[model samples]
Every structure is written in C-alpha cells, then in structure tokens.
Target: MPGNADTLTTIAALKSVSKRYGSVTAVDRLTLEIRRGEILALLGPNGAGKTTSVNLLLGLAGPTDGKAELFGRAPRDVAARRRIGAMLQGAQLGGHARVHEMLALYSGYYLDPLPRMETLRIAGLEGLENRPVVKLSGGQKQRLLFALAICGNPELLFLDEPSAGLDVESRRGLWAAIRRLKEQGRSIVLTTHYLEEADALADRIVVIHCGRVIAQGTPAEIKNTVAQRHIRCVTGLSAVQVKMLPGVTAVNSDGERLDIVATRPEHVLFEMLRLDPALQDLEVTGAKLEEAFLALTDDNREAQAA
Candidate 1:
C-alpha cells in the first residue's frame, strides 16, 4: 500500500532494487516508496538490509541492479539530494564544536535552511547550544545530532534510530517533534528497532526480511496478521489446566495468576471463566507490533528454508 500509484503522492522510491557484497546479496530486488506527508517506518531485524535500503535511497551506495530515485530523479541528483536530510547512527560529531555553531554550518549547505533558534527548539537543544559537544551527556549528544539533521529544513528526512540514547521523557519529546514535522507536510522514513515507537508514529509500516519486503501495512493491519491474543487474569486454575483449553496455544502462570496466549480468545476466556469462577483482573489485549514482527520474520525464514 505504500507505493500506491493512484491518487496519493510519492516522494522517493526504490524500484526492484538489489545490492550485493561479493557473493552475498544484501538487498534482493526490493521495492519500496516513501509517501508524501507520511511517516513510513522501515522495520526489520538486525542485518535485514534496512541499512542497505536507506543507503541506496540516500545515494550513499549504488545498487547492483535496478534503480533508486529521489524526487522522481536519480538518487544522486544534486537538487534531489538537497531536499532530503539524514540523521544516522555512529556520526562523529567533534567534541570541540558547539551546538549552534554546528547547526549553522550544516544549515549553510541548503539553499533555504531553518532558523538556528527553530532548529534548536525542534531538537530540544535550546538550553545547551553553547555547551561543548564532548561535555554533553549521551542523550544530549543524540539531540544535537538530530538538530544538525533538520537544520537544512529538508522536505524529507531519514532518521536511523533517532531516539536510541534518549530516556523515556526525551524519547516522547522527540516523537512529538517528529509528528510536528509531518504536520508541516514533510515526509519521513524512520528506521527504528523500537516497535512501539513505530506503532506510535508511522502511518505505514514496511517490514523487510532476508533482503525483501515480507509485510507492509498500517499498525492495525500488521497487528491483525497475528491472531494471537494475550489474556491475563488472576485465577485459581493451574497453567496445565488452562493449556488444556481447545484454543489455547501457551499458558504461563504464577501461582494465582495466568497469562495465556491463544488463537481463539473467546473460547479460551469462556473456558477459563467456567473453570475459575473467582478469576479477577482479566485483561484481553490484541497482538503488539513486536509480536507481529517476530511472527512475520520467522514465517519468512521458514518459507525460504522450505
């Protein structure tokens, strides 16, 4: 659904793209698109070609086959490159550089950049603009990297693990800032291991595995792929007894409480209720993004093996 060529717009795309490193393929005919004014989360486990896909889009790596496009042109096109900003991991921000100064430097690279104060505000670096990069804490430095990335005020952004070093509060603050960017009609390609973050921010999610897309959909749609529901309750029924339920997949219990994963939650709940009339604090929740991710990737792997 991400590359729907109907009425929706596309900002960037990779058409049947492939990348190889010697004998091994890093990306295998991958097709992806960044939709306009949307937060698209590109998700995959470690070494799943996520970095390769981003590199191809950013023109940092040339594809072995097929094509990568930005603004409907070659990824390396100067004008197209200028319209995108990238915030990546392992960037070497010098210890001597101050926050505002670095922002000024990077902003100068673009034809029209965001104001220094605005960049600082968006990055949550306002109070630390004068602090040396080395003296700042890990989280503070992460914020500075984010500030530099947005200084150019690009129409599209590629964020790689943007909230890695942030605490809970700081991470939420950054998420809010990202939402504001989307509100301004800017498109973003976000790659994060935090499934909850993807669930919270992304309008669309693309899951890649073994160098190709395995699943792509909205958060709800993705979660729906896994029919496993979790039911937790305080009950007197033993774990063995609950596992005997017809639809129950697995059951874990700690004395008086039971945590059950089941395909037919209604049947499981009915049986549990009938078995343990004193059951309390019952909660039935849908599958989380992480659960769906694991199931999809594992299924992909199994299919390839077979």
Candidate 2:
C-alpha cells in the first residue's frame, strides 16, 4: 500500500520516480511512501536499486523521470529536511574527537538538539562519552552513529543498513533503540539485507529487484504470498515419495527426517502420518521472509533474463 495517494501527507513519497546511470536504470518507475510512526524496510538483493532509491528520497540525486518528495517538498528543500535525520551506510565520525564533542558539533546544526548526556544514554554510549571516536569498536561506532541520528530528535529517519557490522548484542540494542524511536511516533525507513531485521521491526516491507518494486506488504502478508507451510517430520520416507503427496510442493530427506513444503499443512500432516503411522516429529511453520525473498527475486531475475 505504499505510495498510495491517501498516505501522501504522512512522511516521504516517490512518484513514478526513476534514476539512471548511463545505460543502467538504477530505479524504475518507483512509487512509494513512508507512513508516520511506522518502520518501513526496503529490501533487495545487490544491485536492486536500494541505495539509489534512498538517495532519491534524500534529494542527493534527482529522479530521471517522476518526483520524490519529503513532506510534500522536494528532498533538497532544506526546511523539509530539518525534521529528518540520516545515517548512511559508511557515515564517518571525527575519529580523534571525543564522543561528546562530536555530538555537540553536530547538534549545533539543529534547532533543538537533545542534551549531550541524554543522547549518549539513549544510544547506550554513556560510559564512552569521553572516549575518542577513533578507539570505538565497530558496534560502538554504530551506536555513535545512532546517537548522532537522534541528536536532532527528527520526526523522520533514514537508516541505511544500520546493523551491518554490529555484533549480536549490539544489533539487539540498536533494534531496541529503533523501536523506541517508533514509540515516539517518528517515521523510519530502514534498508538492510537481514530479513530477520525486517521481520522483527518493519510494519511493512517493500521488496525491490532490478530497480523495480516487486512486492509490498506487511511481514505476514509477504510471507503468506508464498502460500506454503514448511512441515518437518521424523519418518522413514524417500524424498521423491513424500513429494508425491497431495498439497506437497517439495520434499527433502535427511536420513530418517523429512522436510515438506505444502500448501495445506494440516492435510500434509494427516497424509504424512497415514504414510508412516510411526511418524515421531512434526513441526509446521509458515514460509519465512528469507524464503519468500529468494523465490521472488530469483523469479524476477529469470523473467528479466527471458
């Protein structure tokens, strides 16, 4: 439902926007919108035009065709961007500068900057306030970037791969911070390859492939698109035999184990048990975002090739 006219007044909008680099079309006829207080994750495989789309929204690059607007104004409009914060994938901080000093410098650009200690505390960097940015670990650097992002208390945020280099704990901390931002009723646009991140945080997800938006929906909707449930069982059956069962799409065997992909999991379970009454283990799960993404993008690539 992104880019719908009804949601135009919410946050960001791209109207049939396209961007090109010589012969390569980085973005193609894209139209999407970010809703206020919602986390929208833009996902794609490499070269899917994710970065270009973000740049278009930020007005770092103009669209080759339609328009991209932030709060109904162009992305380059300084006044419109005043209420926005951004953290690019490889954003740099003053390496030798102390954390508090760096925050203070960036805060000067905003109308009402968050208190230095408050920003540091929110980002979980309180103990590292006086430490030089240069000595921070990868996760620490990411937290510093987050601190910089919220220092302005912007209403809209753009985070590009916010958890790329973060360790597990650090990533969880960052996720928590993002949720807090959402609770504050701020809109967020996040881009990351981590499907779990999208599943966990995104209110809706838009999937792009080869510069085009291929799918858009909530995580549950997207997963349901596959219409297949994963059923695992401990049984004595050959993979090919299991695949022949009604409703079964795929079957894999690992010794005495069976993994079945089926359209109707309940029916599949009944049939599996009928096939082998001694079936011991059965686990039914919906299709995951990762599986849907792979299947969708691969199909897109194949279609493009054809």
Provide the overall lDDT of each model, using Cα atoms, as 2-decimal numbers. 0.85, 0.84
Model 2 stretches with alpha carbons more than 4 Å out = 1-8, 226-247, 253-258, 274-289, 299-306
Looking at model 2, residue 288 earns an lDDT score of 67
TM-score of 1: 0.84
Deviation in Å, model 1, residue 51 alpha carbon? 1.9
Model 1, global lDDT: 0.85
State the lDDT of candidate 1 residue by residue for 127-241, as single tens digits: 8988878788888888888888888998999998788778999999999999999887788998876667888999998888778998889977765554678899998888888
lDDT of 2 at 187: 86
**Backbone clash tally for model 2?**
1
Predicted candidate 2 versus true structure: per-residue lDDT over 1-306, tens digit per residue: 335454445678899999999988999999988887789999887778888899999998899999999988989998888888888888876569998888998888788878888888889998998899999987888889988888988889899889888888888988998998887777899997767888899999998887898889998876665467888888876788878888876787777677887767888788878889988877888876567567777667777799
Clashing pairs in 1: none
RMSD of 2: 3.7
What is the alpha-carbon lDDT for the whole of candidate 2?
0.84
**Model 1 spans > 4 angstroms off:** 1-7, 232-259, 271-291, 302-306
What is the alpha-carbon RMSD of candidate 1 to the true structure?
3.8
| Clash totals, every prediction | 0, 1
